[model samples]
Target: MSRIYRHPTQPTVELPPVDLLTLLFDSEHSLAQDDTILHQEAANPSNTVNKRQLRDLVERIAHGLRTNYGIGAQGPNKDVVTVISYGQMLVSAAFFGVIAAGGVYSAASPSSTVAEPARQVKIGNSRLLICGKEHQAVTTRAAEECGLPLSSVLLLESSPEWKLRSLEGGIDVVSSSRLSWQTITDRQALKDSLITILWSSGTTGLPKGVMLSHENLVAETYITALSGRQWAAKEIEKGNELPAVQYRTLGHLPISHIAGLFGYLLAPMYSGGSVVWMRKYNWEDMLKCLKQYEITAFYTVPSIFLRISKSPEVTDHFKHLVGASTGAAPMDGKLQMAANAKLGSGQDAMIGQTWGLSETTGAITMMPKGESDTTGSISPILPSVELRMVDDDFNDVESGQEGELLVRSPLVTNGYYNNPQATKDAFHDGWFCTGDIGSLRDGKFYIVDRKKELLKYKGLQVAPAEIENVLFTHPQIKEAAVVGVPAPDDPGTDWPRAYVVPVGPDAVSEDDVKAWVADRLAPYKQLRGGVMFVDGELPKNAIGKFLRRELRDRAKREMGIKAKL
Candidate 1:
């Protein structure tokens, strides 16, 4: 059987073909009747940019990029400018401005250490870095290492000495509008021109520069707005309506991320909703923001959901919330149910859950507004997207069987920047290999695990997520990860081991933990390899996905054998 997904609206509708800037600020697309697009939380007291203010600000920055740096003077050249900051008011402006000026900006996480950001600067070959004061030292050092002058570093703050104002003061509308910003020759030019480069979270290895075009982003924004899986629409359907209440977004994730860029930022902007910013995330602060903003839609990762779903504060604090989404990592059926039960009501209320990679822009599969899904099952594929489940030889798998996900569409990225070999390896025929294991049933998709991350124990493949899901059911367990370690006595065979972070200071015996699982699973599936406990949180990437490879290496070191990971 062949499985392909098409959006409900795909047949009659097509995404507008224009540059990202035109899509964002054009009068035709503005959803805001009041011209508001950003909502600054008290946590970020000094930042707010409405649609008009934001447009002027982006235009001003676009003018500066052209006049000072001549970034686009050569006509759609790949002069990369790096933006490293949290979701500041102007970071949005900088993002659109760089593209508006015909230069592409790469989004780097503020959580990046010296080596990571430095490698990005080198790979991007960035001529200038737009950053914040918080990561000043690391970025400055990275710029130096990349042989870029200190003057190439631009801060995200106001500088009267330099005649530049923070987005905080707002830009001069007249002066900004006067600047003749560069424009593409045609819609085709805009569609093909590069707009932004975002880094892939290097779970397996080094992060690659994923280049996305104006058409790619514009399509993603439009599809999200039209998609029934979009959380904001679900919120209204759940009876959270109020008089003159604008749809608002609460985002604590880095705006530089694809999820942050699309689901949390651009889609909301495209829909004429305001985004409330959070500089950093904590469960307690998240609870406070829910009430303070009466935030209708919330998009976050499963780790945060795990903590909050189990917290006493969820039902009480999240009453005003219309919908909740888990991203960055997959949520198990058990945890997904708990989250939906708390966040949802009747047959609806819970919204958002789909999957995408940097290659597919943001989300490629989303649940329609009127539907619900199983714990691990994500919604059907988007209408504008085409996908397949293929076996090791690239032959199509049966619909109900697991295989690597291969996707094709305008939503797919061109390839990694400056790496032709990697670009070639990432594609087969016209399809981009997703590196994820998945299966389809009734148009819904289930992500089994990463192909490379699957563990072999006693000739059977074990998904770490499967064991981790069971661990989550244990009330004493706060977080858990499973990895296969080489049997100490035999290098050829492997056995499963679990690393856990307990909820509190209370002691949990290893044997007791092993016994709890022994009765639940087959003897081979038991934790016969043993259990190890960590005093702190497990190592994770910026988006909260577990770095399981790191855990395997740690287990190798502890056992005093050079175990192959």
Candidate 2:
């Protein structure tokens, strides 16, 4: 029997079975319809997008895609449009526009190499490619390699006014034409309809596309926001003064990832918040924006918080910050407390920790406002989410015992896109296997370890198997294994390190191995943890499987001790 755990304090609420666009723009739940929801940071008058302008832009882009590009001529979700760009206010338009045209949005990292986006483009069978001006070089090559014509590739420019035009200058998105997204109320259709494809590295193997639906996004947005909404209501009922903070945040993370997708695109519209877009993440620029925009709440990773705790330039930037949360990687308890101290002046602000994966859309567990936990534990499960801890035998464990955490929620992805075997392997019964080992104690959850071999560097997923596959292509490498070693400078982050048995001694140097990977993979996937040439062979078991645990332990012991010296 399984001992399932539901949220202890919060009750489940009914989720609307409408399309994502309808829920955001046309439903009773919509907020900030007449207010500014998107802003460009550092602009003189700060280019802003109200709800009406956003809807008009989305409709025009949808019409242009359908009439000019034939995106949805065959109906919805069949056409995949790939977008690669950094943070910009207009990127949200591209996202909704694709969905409004009954097309699926496929996001790729702007920092990706030619081969990376090319592989994704081929996987999705993408019909059209879109990119920001800065990434035109990489997108051009990727589109060419994918055999997509230059006419099918569009450039998204935001500076001198928002425009989506073809490189050949034949097609441009204009406001004269408009198309509205079909309002969906059928529960089954909402559950089955695919709206976005966000790539994630599962427990093992190369990166796979995670397919999310309208139901998934709606459930995630509603459940994640419920606690805060309830708290605000109760405070008002008691006639107590609430914090005088607006729902403003800074968008400094990549829009391709789940955190950025939900935080920047979906959540703000529902909460009546405003997001100030940063073209790319710069530490100094981010600090200035926080103060400049008077950002009240933000979602970031542990690495950025680590910087805030140590950097002298962090003072007064977060004085107006009332809410802060960190995820994507583990955070030390001391570091969490130190970072919390830098938040709002007279408020009882705490930097909460959230835990989830791309499979869960964004967060399954987050601490509610007015609560503080500095014990390195991810807070309570959100409303309507069910959790279970199961041992190796598939039996439930006691409350305090650690086991592989399984979750059941509408927020979980349907499965990996176009990979039936992988999808089938990801679930057991009706529960989604999270590949994380964790425990539930007194209504709070603690993630003890990752059963999966995936490593997160600066909140980006880096699969060791992906790197090893790339290494095997090198001529001089015989056998190779990769493991994550703790980064010396950045606490609570891991960098990929490789242990290699070369074909011969001195045949391949460390720089040669690093450069080989840099040329083939994205910058985040590069082996910053350095490479070591092993003497004989990598440790293996009786069946000749590489003992990665031994390598991980050795790397940590050797590398961590050396850093101290």
Best by TM-score: 1
lDDT of 1 by residue, 400-460 (tens): 8889999888889889999999899999998999999988766567888888888777677
For candidate 2, the lDDT comes to 0.83
Per-residue alpha-carbon lDDT of model 2 for 330-429, expressed as tens digits?
Answer: 5546567767877877245478899898899989989987788887678888888898999877799998877889989888999987889889998999
Q: What are the root-mean-square deviations of the candidates from the true structure over C-alphas?
A: 4.1, 10.8
At residue 285, candidate 1 shows an lDDT of 79
In model 2, what lDDT does residue 213 have?
94
TM-score of 1: 0.90
Write down the TM-score of every candidate: 0.90, 0.81
Candidate 1: C-alpha lDDT: 0.74
